[model samples]
Each structure stands twice: as structure tokens, then as C-alpha cells.
Target: MKFTGSIMITCVKATELIEKRQIQSLTLGERFKLRLHNSMCVACRAYQRQSKTIEKAISRWMHITNNTTHHLSQEKKDKIIEELKKL
Candidate 1:
């Protein structure tokens, strides 16, 4: 379905979109709308960037932890915890 230009997605829905890239491959029309909406909506843009950062961090953590059954190195674990603390 085509998005009507009149309505912007809600914050929760925009977050979902950020996490899933649900509309990353937007049609040209949708892309234009998103750009306009994001430019005007600081909250939505912040939510999107924060959520995307979380998604990437989770992926990286998974990759690091999945490499072996052995416990994660203490240094690595401490670094991760430190970074999370900053968040």
C-alpha cells in the first residue's frame, strides 16, 4: 500500500522500522516523505539513530560471543560492560 503524504509514522512504528529496516528500501515517494519527516522530527530521528546503534551493537556482541563455547575473555567482557555503561 502507498503511504499518504499527510500522515507520518508514529515513534513506536518508526522504531520498528529502524530495527527491522522495514522500509529501508522505500519507494521514491516514501523516501521523500521519510526524509521530510525525519528532518522535522528530532525525536523520531534520535530514536531511529539510537535504535540502529543498539541493533548494530547487539549484532556485534552476538558475533563475538558466538565464536566459541569458551567464556568470553575478561578484557572483552569489561570493555563491553564499560561501553554499555556509557549508554
Candidate 2:
């Protein structure tokens, strides 16, 4: 199937396009083809959903880590390291 300036993309191509969309903007033709594939393909749709869910989760985790100032005490860190060595 044609992907860039053409029509009809396969499931694999569609999923690749989905991932590319997350990192960069897709061309009009590429977006059209991906949407067409998603309309008819259940697995691709599910994959897209799962990808978005993971992206959101990672974004949230990063945001929380960046904004929070929770630091472990030196004693806590040493204790944890000692416990790990015991294993």
C-alpha cells in the first residue's frame, strides 16, 4: 500500500505512523491513510489507545519527578544500600 503521497496503508505502516505522530507532525496524506486504517482495523485502534495511555503515564511520572523535591536522607540511602547488599 502507498503511505506518503499515496493511499491504503497496512496495519504495520499505520502503527508506525501512529508512533511517528507522537514525535512529529504527519503529512496530510499520511494522516489520512492512518485514519482510514484505524477506522477499519480493531487491533490498530487498540494499539493506538495503548500507546496514548503509556505516553500519558510517562509524562505524568516525569512531571511529578520534576516538580517534587522529595529527597531521601543519607541515612535512609545507606540503610537501603546495606539491605540490598544483604540480599
**What number of backbone clashes does candidate 1 have, counting pairs of residues 3 or more apart or in separate chains?**
0
Clashes of 2: 0
Q: Which stretches of candidate 2 lie over 4 Å from their true place?
A: 1-6, 60-87
Candidate whose TM-score is highest: 2
Task: Put down candidate 1 lDDT per residue, 1-87, tens digits, no spaces.
Answer: 466655576666555555556445656655665667787889989887777788789888877746557887999999999999999
For residues 33-54, could you state the per-residue lDDT of candidate 2 as single tens digits?
8888899999999999999999
| Candidates' C-alpha lDDT | 0.70, 0.89
The alpha-carbon deviation from the true structure for residue 36 of candidate 2, after best TM-score superposition, in angstroms, is: 0.9
Taking every candidate in turn, the Cα RMSD to the unseen true structure, in Å, is 13.4, 8.0
- Pairs in steric clash, model 2: none
